[model samples]
Target: MTHRFVGVGALTDVPRVAVVIDVMRAFTVAAWAFSRGAERIVLASSEEEALALKAASPGWLALKDGPPAAGFDAVNSPGLMRSADLAGRTVVQKTTAGTVGALAVADAPLVLCASFVVAGATARFLRAEGREPVTFVVTGEDGRADEDLACAEYIGRRITDSDVEAGPYLRRARTSKAAGELADGVRRGYRGVDPDDVELCLEADRFDFVMAARREESLLVLRPLPRAAVDDGGEERRTARR
Candidate 1:
């Protein structure tokens, strides 16, 4: 089994499994949100849709565009998961790139969100389930983000059980052009971006589970892969999803 990589805007082909990478924050935020006991995350195609869904369910937390919408609990911030008491809550997430990339390749047999938090586990899953080629979709901020590429490269190395140290990839990402925007807050403005989120995103295998997506009536509901618990950072819990 082999692996391929594509930028956010250039996902021209599909594979047996599609793992979307958004290490800068989108997917990472979702993983951390779930860690804080978020019931489930509903991926919306647009901010309007997310807001509408949240309006339907009073308690649902919607990560919307612009300043926290009238009643939104928080924006798309991975750091919020650490400090917010989001237990027993539902999150409706709509992002510019990450979610879009996942939906673009939703046609695949499997669609999973990949960040450094689950990079190792994703590689293990690929290794165990090598029946076909897998593709890593690097959802850049818009075109290409250093963080997403770093996650993709790290996972690609892990697929072959190579000596992949998370440090270099992150270092490379930090020094790249887009990563600069992380500090400067280009697309979302300085207040919208959090350098801390980038720091947290660099934590490899931070979660015990990998987030997977399911398409339901045009809506992709994302949840931790069933029983996905990583013992000792879930590295040993490298079971593949069949």
Candidate 2:
């Protein structure tokens, strides 16, 4: 299998499986939300879709970039989901990087959302089942961010074809110019840059499953599937594309 890394700017060329990385906060919060008993997650490509889904469905929570909307239950923050009651609730996520990147590559045979939490599982799936020429799409905030690239490298390494480590990579990422800018964004009142999010995004292999996106009617449904179950009827099927 061949592995290539591209920032979100180059989403045109894709492979059978495109693993999108958003380790900073968006997907990390998603893993935690699912672990806390969230029934399902709808990855809305735009804010309008999230609101429309919230209006049409019961037990659905919508989160845009910054905070939760006035009537929603939570935002895309791991710290926020740490104590929320997500049992049997369906979550709707529309974020700056993670969800958008996956939607951009929805044409692929499969789209898997990656972070440190699901890194190991992603690697295992790619190693065992990925077709030749799998690509990694690192979706950064503006152009490219160290945290997302670091996540891509980590997944590359775990695939046994590339070599990158968490220790040195994360250390540099945490202190990189991007990190500084992210902190400044928070100070400037930006959404999705809590210090706690940075901390949560750095952990490795926190979950046994990886999240994948599939197009549902008027929405992309992203839910976690166990790594070992990828070929055993987990059914990462695409619904509809428009």
Candidate 3:
């Protein structure tokens, strides 16, 4: 099986398995939190739900969605996740693009969550397993350019067996003014974050876990690939160029 990339709205030709990216904040923060040992992530489609879940859970960390503007919880900053103790903790996250996009594909045969930081790992996992007809869904923010597309391009390169290059998508993402603005915002508020985290998210094929999204009761949960299923395999790898 081969993989193709498409924007969020163009999901009419949904595949059996899909990987969604909204790296700017949602999934990036989720991935970082997981790396920090977060037990699970509850993705709230709205702020109200996220807060409610947090209130109900007492100790669960909460994040609100805000884009084109600041979110209720200081926007999506990796630094914020780093500073907190998320080990074995649960996070309720709401994001403009990430959570909404994941829900849009809830009916997909298989939905995997992804971010820039784990693009390489996602590609390698898909290749090793040979999952076919995979769709790299870029959850765009209000139809504008964002980190989702960039992360898609990075993953597209890794899983595709074709000769097509992901250079154009990667180049566009690197030069996007929006990305620059977001980076600047982060730099201004938190000086310790390496500008390379931004750059690293743009790199192709970096990690090994393919995040999986599933609904647990009413909340959408995302977490790393289970340890037992890491070696599964089946088809040819393909990139979604456009």
Clashes of 3: 12
Per-model tally of clashing residue pairs: 1, 0, 12
Instruction: Identify the runs in model 2 with alpha carbons over 4 angstroms from their true place.
Output: 161-164, 181-195, 230-242
What TM-score would candidate 1 get against the native?
0.85
- Cα error of candidate 3 at position 80, Å: 2.4
Error of 2 at 65 (Å): 1.7
- Candidate 3 lDDT, 9-69, residue by residue in tens: 8778656778888766667777777877888888887888877787787778777543323
Cα lDDT tens digits, model 1, 28-133, are 8888888888878898888778888989988998885434566666777776567777789889988878888888887777778889887877776666556467
lDDT of 2 at 60: 84
